[model samples]
Target: MTQTAPSYVLGSSEQEIARLDGQAASIEAATRLLLRAAGIGPGMRVLDLGTGLGHVAGLVAELVGPGGQVVGLDTSARLLDVARERARDRPQVTFVEGDVRSWRDAEPFDVVVGRLILFHLHDAGAALRHQRTALRPGGLMLVLDFDLGSSRADPPVPLVTQALGWVDAAFRSAGANPTIGTRLAPLLAGAGLVDVQTFGVQGYLAPDDPRGPALLGGVVRAVAPQIMALGLATAEQIGIETLAERIDAATRATGSVVLPPALAGAWGRRAL
Candidate 1:
């Protein structure tokens, strides 16, 4: 008998595009670090797990160049639509709608990569084990995720700190890990991967950073429903309509900066 696979809790909606747009810069920065850490280069076949908007896949496609191929897989058709649009000019990259846990193919790839996708899984280790089968011996697997609990702001912004707690609670309530970043190496090792390594990246929002508030606000608004359902906040407190402006105002008023969650990247090679 076949076992059922878990689904992605946060869906692919217009909201996903908004989130991706808001975090584009930071994502690009992390992408560079992840690709370099995994030693991705030209002519290498890559599998992008939980491809989402496919922005990362586009980056990998460029690095893999014309001779290589990129297969981006995600569970959300909505996201795959956006991904396709994002990659319309790049024939080397292809997006498919599929669950990472159940996805398999006869051909193996040189590299498998994902960002901010692991923590959302019910069983990330199990998914890694499955994805590993799609990798050739000694192929690389790189994942970038977050440790929300380690998030901090200098000079202490009470509201920002409190907001993170709500975010963590909501994620946990939805059966996701808010702090899965720091655990990836052990997860990889347990999955039978070799030479596991982990790295950390901090996302800082300067007091005068133009996009700082918008990014944080977009995230707050996007997750407001989950926050409310988890009883972490009430509708009035969530204030979806005004939350973004209010957060922007509050940070400016206090002369404080916002620090997004600390991100962590982990990589390991498929055992030979």
Candidate 2:
């Protein structure tokens, strides 16, 4: 059984980068809280995988302070440029171009972070095992990903529900795991990390807030090309242009806040 692995559905494009930056605004605080709780602090050498627009990497830089070093690695050199520009003020933060599964450093990291990157991987457990090798003994490893199955519009907006399903289907078709969050503890343990533990961070975007709908719509928009190419959806069906407006309208009508998938954090430490 040669099952083809999933590809990166959300591509690296100017538009996609902008949308990601917009989405990052809403989730930064939550991510910071998770990183802090994960015990990332000053003097730690941290490796941030799939750094994207460098949101999480910036946060880690702040947490680690001037005493620590943060290296953000991504396959897209374009993204690495964005990350570098954004991190210019932070001397301790650096951006490197590489793949998470194969990139290595002679100097081991005190912590390894894989945020929103697990689902994109074909063999996430194997990837974790490889990453674990880069961690120093007793190094902390953090895996944060979205449990998108939990995302929905309160009062059950049909359109909202349908929209969620569309994203899930597209992701699944791409071979990504939209709901891998809740099942991370065992994955970490299986990767040979000890003291495996898990946590969840939830963010509620008020009914009137545009961020929630924007976040949801942005994802669909980013993956629309791939979605259409895969025959999982069509552009007209996705309504690429006004998707956010419609989602916001529906959520506002219900007076129910929008919940964008729970941020599940699973972490463990390498053997001491």
What residue runs in model 2 are displaced by over 4 Å at the alpha carbon? 1-6, 230-233
Give Cα-based local distance difference scores for all models.
0.80, 0.86
What is the Å distance of residue 263 in model 2 from its true position?
A: 0.6
Residue 225, candidate 1: how far off, in angstroms?
Answer: 1.8
Model 1 lDDT tens row, 146-186:
88877755657666676767777777877779899889889
> Against the true structure, whose lDDT is highest?
2
Total backbone collisions, model 2: 0
Candidate 1 runs further than 4 Å off: 1-7
lDDT of 2 by residue, 9-91 (tens): 88778888888787677777778878988899989999999898889988898888899999999888888887888889999
Model 1 alpha-carbon miss at residue 46, Å: 0.3
